[model samples]
Target chain A: MAEERTPLYRRLSRRHLFRLPLLHSRNGKRRWPIRSAGINFALGYGVLFLISATLFLSFIWWSSTNLLNDHVRAFIETDAQELRHRWGHGGAPALSEAINDRLEQNIDDDALYLLIDRHGRRMAGNLPGWPVAVKKMNHFYELTIRRYTFTTPAQFKAYTLPHGFKLIVGHDIRGRTLLSTVITRTLIWCAVMISLLAVGGALVVRDLFRRMVGSIARTASAVANGDLNHRIALTGSETDLVAETVNTMLDRINRLMEGVRQVSNAIAHDLRTPITRARNQLEEAFFSATSPDELRTAVDRAIGDLDHITGIFEALLRIAQIEAGARRSAFTTVNLNQLLSNMAELYEASAEDAGLSLALDVTPLPSLFGDERMLQQALANLLDNAIKFSPPNSMLTLSAHPVMAGTAPGSGAEKKPQGLEISVRDQGPGMNDADILRAHERFFRAESARNTPGSGLGLSLVQAVTSLHHGRLTLTQANPGLKVTLFLPLLPEAERTGRSTTPAETTP
Target chain B: MRILLVEDDPTVRSFVLKGLKEAGHNVDQADNGKDGLYLAIGEKYDIIILDRMLPGGIDGLNILETLRGQKNNTPVLLLSALSDVDDRVDGLRAGGDDYVTKPFAFSELLARVEALGRRGHNESAPETSLTVGDLTLDLLSREVRRDGQKIDLQPREFRLLEFLVRHAGQVVTRTMLLEKVWDYHFDPQTNVIDVHVSRLRQKVDKPFETAIIHTVRNAGYILRPTQD
Candidate 1:
């Protein structure tokens, strides 16, 4: 029923498996045979198998034929030696009698003998006459002779005896010839069998390869068609590695796409509120304002709201730009010591005004290559958050030191430091586990920070700047406070020096 | 002061023209880059405010480059909607004296324009010492003295005072102070600039009988000999 359910052309093609065309047109487009890796693999395997099998069979045929020829030559040499001795002891007549006796004693009837006189006339032999082709004495030759009713091919050796009599000793090789012919016939049959097996094996291999890759191809096409949920099923085969890697990549892409979607949604929600608020305020002022002062106050407030909205827009655009790595070109050799101190001094007065004491603990460090302005901005955001959350008289500790890669916070490893760790700890109502996990998400305001007057993009911008520097940002609860650490890797000398210098602005 | 205003948007152009005229400046208006360039070249203006994107074939940068190439030394402040740092760099690299992104407060524009106008007049001679009322700033010694009484200041504070004293009687915004004094460009989330100015005021104004650094509501800070 299933076979009948398929299209008629598919069913017809399925019946003639061997006649399957390597190249077929689908939807009016010709599919190239070479495009199929399975077909290429099968062809290569089949050709190699055929060549090796032919060589092996040829080796067997040559060795077997040589063994049979050697056996015949050994027998002819021994028989000729014994007959020559007989001719020497009993003369030509004795040799002729001996040759007849051997012929009569031959149970297999494969013996051949011939004795020629000085004038080259055959005296005693199974052959009709001296072979005209056997012109030399003491040499082996092959000739046909009449054994009984049938003529058979035989190997012979002509030997010169006393009184110029030539005695030719030979053996009938019809059995050996038949055996060799049978071996040749069997080898040919085997070659044909091997060729058939190779082709069948190739088909099996190609089928397996296609089945493995077909799953992946189907999943990819499904994804291309907007079905991102489709995934290649793992078959526990060697191809599972590739399938797993592809699945992992798809998961990452899905996550990124989801992030983009969420950001768009958040932007719409975030921007709409202020815009609606501003519009409503202006509309209300237009209809109700009876005095210029009242109208002016309403307009000023609207402008302030608009400015706040603009600030949010600028922050979002900067974060997006930084995440896109567009600001990397502005990287330069920044003196960390000077930068940290300047930032500390710049923000110290603000922290003091907020009734918080700011402490800076920066160890002597080498120069860092980065966009000083961006790093400063990130630090400013962190400090801003710290001061905003901290209670009066609380100490905001901003510290920086060198750290080795892979070493956790406060772990003292003896290895050389490979990166810089800058942390800001604030004594505030720290975030919970869930909020900490999502603190860097754009527009994610923590419960403790819900009342704070911020656009909720501070940490996101910090995250963007950290990632742009090939760094990692982590937030951990510092027992009574929260600690935000930015771990920036130290670029190697080659990378630092290899950067192309951007053109500087000329003074007018 | 004579000012040239080049903007394509009628709303923004009329608003800026009205503001400049109200501020007692002779203003020349052009709706496109072609007329703007012609007016800028034909007249000697104290400042030229050029919009980055114009309707005509010529652009703000093109006019700027042509003027600079001809050694026209009038300071040009670029008004643009492109707010990226690279865009600002491109504008400045093309001989723009300053860049103000769109959606700007008129006060910021006026402040920057007045600053640019003052810069053209102040470039004629270099002064070793600047005096604003009783406040004196020694350029060679990096010393600031009020009423001939030496006032010790930190290195950063001296630079801040020098910038303020040089642009005396001008409304200097927080961004200007941040860029000119700290050599950094970015908006601090909080009023950090206010804190710094307060610190400066504590030393320069708190002890003195006269206050020099006065905050302009909704604008920034202005350092004058006397308060308004």
Candidate 2:
């Protein structure tokens, strides 16, 4: 309906420019195809070419006529002088005889001569009074005359001569004029006909190209508006590279969307269990508790269950925040040593309470650029997992050292540039190949560690935070347990040494 | 003794009602804030139990706020499912004399009610001590005597005994214990309340020849003169 309401030009402009059509689109839009640009250019050129051709041909015709007339005038003047010379030497008889002899030799036509002794009469030529006898200096004039010849009938001109003699000459130019007219008319007709044909051909191509591109555009619009299932119909013969590129991009986007859907589902499914459990526990206590002691016990159990639920929720929220890619703008120069040391202190008691030996081997480190809270959370989760999964009393070692200055592969780009490498090693059951690969999958629990109580969101959170920091997290087995190492680029020494305590901004 | 309960959940209301009934107190239930407020204003309840979340334009917090606004000194025990410390702080700040979380055991509910009831009575009766039967208490001196012998008590135990005695024959709810004696502030959702109550009971009741504090099965406790 909207398409019908909007003129065609509007739709075209909008599709081309990715915006609403401007005011000029109110007219019933012209269905200009993509080939319209070329078609318009060709049509305009052809029309101008035809107009110029007509003018050129007409000029040529006029110029040819003028040139022939000039030649005739020159010949008459010379011939008349010769006639006077003849008349002066031998009187009128000689001139008449000469004129008659010249006429008899002109069997080809377009030739004429006359001799009149100062009288309005022709003497020695086909019957024709002097044509265009307007006054001239020396009694000379030029004019077209209709006359009859001994053999042919045609138009001729009489050039009156001096001393009682006139010379009339004629030669047939009508046949030549007819042939030139045919040639000029044929050339003009060919030019105009070709131009009209070119315009017709261009319109056809414009309409064809419009349909082809419009179909693809419609499909793309549908996809942009969230109909991921829509695919461009590879219509027309021109669909080669464009169709291939669009299809590939759509395939990748669909895959990414699927992954997001799966993660969302996992969060919903796993978090509900603990929340329901806590609710049920509370309900039971409210109904059956007999004394203050029983009531307090019930409330305690419910609170504990709620704590677990909150834990999962908090972790999920943190991961989501990291994934939103906003933390990049909040990056600041952070002291890795101080950040790690703070975490080490915070988790030491927790680790001690869990009967795990936790150690922080901090090598004096340069500053790094990142969100402090996110880094702390990521590191804390890693350490928490190590402490939780490892057997009680196992030694867990944490170390941070600079990536050797020039150890990067072939590129000297980041050579010897100070970046910190942090690793956490545990002495409990180590992860095998399968576990290591899928550890970052949300809600994925290791087969050997299923009995333990956890939501399996830790590694995923760690991965998200690491990505936010523009860092890499590698998981490997430490011979006896799991080892997770993180590499984060370091800020220059000046920024790191400037200030120690600043909260990271969340705006980005 | 009489008690007033204000809670929105039907399940929780019925369970708490049954427990208090078994504890031998006349129990009144109000589903939401308006009805609860009407009840609190019209009736003289030994203790008023309030739920933080309620329907009908009045929540536990609102009821407490209104009650305090009206200068009604009836002790209110606020109940909720939220156990966060911030929530507790807000509830208490809103004039809730005591606060408790949901999924509470009946016993803890009764203990809190009794404590609030006793605290309310003590405010009324500012005299240092009050005695019934052979048990005598000196509030000013913080002393207790049973059969003419001085009996020492922990602060929590003294507070518990004081609540039981104040409402000597009434049933208290577990929500009561959470709010009053422990001043739990937030629901720990742990058995810490029960553990503390048991220790108090062992000290206050177990050593006595005539137990003044009697557990009422699913209901709370009753402090009465020796039956003999």
Candidate 3:
């Protein structure tokens, strides 16, 4: 019912959409080009660059234009001051003469002067008559005036004289306007060049981004298509870091895939014997048994064989479940000292029955947060292995002690070990280096152990339990015996108190 | 013992039915959760064997919760194909008295079912001591005596004997002893339970004229008075 409630496209897109390339839709149609991250990044960079460039150019234009205007204003004020000074000394006649003198001395020929009587008649200046736009006194204005034969825009300031006469001092400002025009044109050209450069830079950046992403995508797609060997090639750039990380991840996946293949093969190979034996026994009982009792015995034996097969399956399932961390919810504070001693006591009788003496050496240990049963099972498996391989009248030692920070041998230098070190040693035929290396693999048995009775999943289960606790398991050849050690890290305070479920830090 | 078995798988259902019938239990069967819930509510049974996954609208946990909600105190044994520890915990947390994983040996199932059935009838006043033949165990003082002669036992052995004596004359599996006596639920690779039982036997029966603890082949161990 829930499946029917969801639309088909929604269901389909939820799983497969992410694996598809950004440029294409699920139906093989071309998607919006800007959806690509590289193009989007480039477009965003271009737009930002253009906006900032526009703001900078606008500021320059505004400031430069204001500077030019201030220069024009200063010239007008100084010229007007000279005229007013002359007016105070010699009245309108000297003021008029001074204006004429300023106009004559102006090299740029961009000066203008106009003097008017109260009756609105022009006295003397370059202008033909008094312009009506200059009505207020001591106020600056821009007005068009006829200077000789040409009309030009001028900045002017008007002043009232002693006999109600008016004087206007003005500057042409044509050169300033031309300079501003040149600046405006330059700014426009610069803007055009900046835009072109921005586009070019964006294209380069997009290309680089695409190259980096494309290789990774291609490698991923290849792997998805069942080509497990495909890998991203490093370009020796800063992106090589990402490339190396991806490559390392691929290697890990490849190894795990290999492990799965080996496990499946081993399961098939190992299970076939018991199954065949059970079938053969049942067939023999059905065809050749003389009495019901004989048939019953055969059937019972077959059932025993079948139970053995089920035991193997159960062990495998338990290992998988532990590795998947499904039992973490059952975690509680477990005292290692108590657990180890209990295990030793439980196995001491078994060890004695096999004519081997089990010695326990334990120090007072801090409690750890873990599934106590799983840890017990792991310890039991280790002790089982030790006793099984031990020779008659030999000593098997089970030891537990706290490993202080940075003290455990062969632990990573960067890892500060703060956990318990539990080891089981047996004076038996120690395994070679190769066997020790492959001991934890599923269903891996050494040549020496071929005749021994075991499912070959003991160490694998132990490894799984250790991993579940974020711990490490190591096997070493102790001269004439084998020593198996488990280093279980202590859960942090938060995890121990059940306030947080963060996984404990792993120690190598 | 009156038992109700709810299982969807025909093979497992018949196997359990035949086994229960042979064991002299009055059995009521249901092939689906709906019928199982109906029968469970309509009739009274001493023990209920419910499968975790059922085909009908109701599941085993739902029935268990409903039965508990109605203030029914019948012991229920949960059967499931999920053998994970979490699944077992979930079944027990949902008012199940015991849990048996699928593909289990009939002896184990029978042991657990009988244990649950016996637990239900044990609602009487608690006993300070248990007796199987001449052997008497004092619970409070943690003491054991045989026919007037005192026999000392380690703490673990005393607890083991206590579980066996409480369920005297009934089959108790190794797993049950491991869980109840030791408070641990794990399968040891070796015969550790057998060794411990042997040690307990050496102390409890080796010097005695009669042996009370007998191994029930392919099942587990049973504690009963020696037959004449």
* Winning candidate number (TM-score): 3
lDDT by residue (B135-185, candidate 3, tens digit) is 899999998998888999998899889999888989999988888888778
lDDT of each: 0.83, 0.68, 0.83
Q: After superposition, how far is residue A332 of candidate 2 from its true place, in Å?
A: 8.0
Model 2 spans > 4 angstroms off = A1-180, A187-241, A289-377, A390-422, A447-454, A464-472, A487-508, B1-228
Using Cα atoms, each model's DockQ against the true complex is 0.56, 0.03, 0.69
User: Of the candidates numbered 1 and 3, which has the greater TM-score value?
Assistant: 3
Q: Rank candidates by DockQ, best first.
A: 3, 1, 2
Assign candidate 3 its CAPRI class: medium
lDDT of 2 by residue, A1-508 (tens): 1222234334343443454423234576654443346465555555556566667776877787768766765666676667668877887788888777777886765565656667666667654665555344344344434555323333334454555455555444554456576867677566747555655655575677677677678778988999987777665477646775677667656755765776679767997888888888788888988898998988888777876776676566556555655445556677788778755654565566667878877767767777765676677778778877878888999888777566842224445655668889999898898888889888888998798878888878778777665567889888899999887756565754443222222111
lDDT computed for candidate 3: 0.83
Model 3: colliding residue pairs: none
Candidate 1 vs candidate 3: the DockQ winner is 3
